[model samples]
Target: MAKHCVCLTLDFDTFSVWSAMGQNSPTPISRGEFGVVAAARLLKLFDVHALPTTWFVPGITLDTYSAVCADIHAAGHEIGHHGYDHISPAGMSRGDEIDQLRRGIEAITRVSGMEPRGYRSPAWDLSENSIEILLGEGFVYDSSMMGHDYLPYRARTGDRVVSGQLPKFGEPSALWELPISWSADDFPHFEYFRGSGLARADDVLANWLGDYDYMTKYLESGVMTYTLHPFVIGRGHRMIMLDRLLHELKDRGAEFLTAEAAVARWAAL
Candidate 1:
């Protein structure tokens, strides 16, 4: 039997992302705080379906909302490391990046009592040493890169790209890269970050389901991943659409799994 998976990833950012972006005033904070409310709604939906998901949370979010995060663990969802302050590591020094990684891991351990084996960057950005740092910290997979749509592969460590020179590919590291795409992410489609938000809910749902159908029709066995934010998709219409999407996926024989679980199954194969 062909095994097809649908990994629903939630970036449970809460107020951390807004705070990191210098939008910590009341209005923006309120906007981010809505995620907490939306998270409750999402958890209800997932509970109704008994679906497992991966939630990438920052240290600040965990520390601030330890109780809710504990509920996520109690519901059997995986809490993956995002960052300490919801800051991107693309410009950080080696030590700073390591600190962010360690802090996030420590927070996760404190909240869930389980060491995280997966990581996804805040802005899908990473410094040159990110893979090395993640390996050193014992991360099994990363979902920050966009190397593939549905296939999970090992993350690369070092690549040489010089001006006016052929690009050199780097050696693959031990960290599994469960690749992601902005196309499949709900932030750009739904969040009004920069004049590009609020697409028709049905339209976006069609596009998401179409991608899954494409995968099942073509690949023998594959993974279909969708990245969403509670604040973005937890709206009334979007939530309805999300529920319908999950049902349709279930009817189509989609097996839902956390990002980490999918990687483990693939690795075992």
Candidate 2:
């Protein structure tokens, strides 16, 4: 059978960045329950389609939003650790990073009853210590590298800390790094390209759909990773756009699975 995978991951840092994007310096916390509502609705859609999703949630998000995390777990979605807070890995000391990761993992486990088997850095902001921390935590995979636009390759885990790149796979204790380029994401487009939340959402979705169509046509056996932000993809008209994208991808014979499952299966091959 042709292998096609869509790893739908929500960068569950909604509340953390909500206030900052508003008036004051991105607040120390996020208060937009709108994101929570949107995420639940999105999960409902996934349930209807029977599409398995991977939610990359920060550790603190679980504490503040435990119900949502529990609901996602109850619905059979895989939960991956994003971080303790949305702290940038590049700015932390090695020891501090390790400690942060430990707490994050424990928090997620406490809330979801599943030790995150996978990790994606907050804002894709990864560093050398990040990989070492992830390995020490016994993570099966890390999806924060951006070596190639689509292909998932491997590298030494610890080496990436200083090199600021993907670890070359070969270290016995190395974890898989799932690469999903920025070009395939909506963050940059919405935050930078269009310069307006409303226009950015629409433009990015159109771009993503175009990218998805092309990938499905040319790379039939290839994997397509869809990264959605609840604050953006979960909003008013944009939610409809996301629904259309999901259903259309399903119609095109794509198999949607959690990032953990997809990487594990791909690694085996």
Q: Top TM-score: which candidate number?
A: 1
lDDT by candidate, in order shown: 0.93, 0.73
Where does the lowest 10-residue lDDT sum fall in candidate 2?
20-29
Candidate 1 local accuracy as lDDT?
A: 0.93
Candidate number achieving the greatest lDDT relative to the actual structure: 1
The segments of candidate 1 whose C-alpha lies over 4 angstroms from its true place after superposition are none
Query: Any runs in candidate 2 off by more than 4 Å, and if so which?
Result: 18-31, 158-173, 191-196, 200-202
lDDT of 2 at 96: 75
Specify the poorest-scoring 10-residue window by lDDT in model 1. Answer: 1-10
| Per-residue alpha-carbon lDDT of candidate 1 for residues 123-194, written as tens digits (9 for 90 to 100) | 999888999999999999999999888899988879877899999989999889998999899999999987
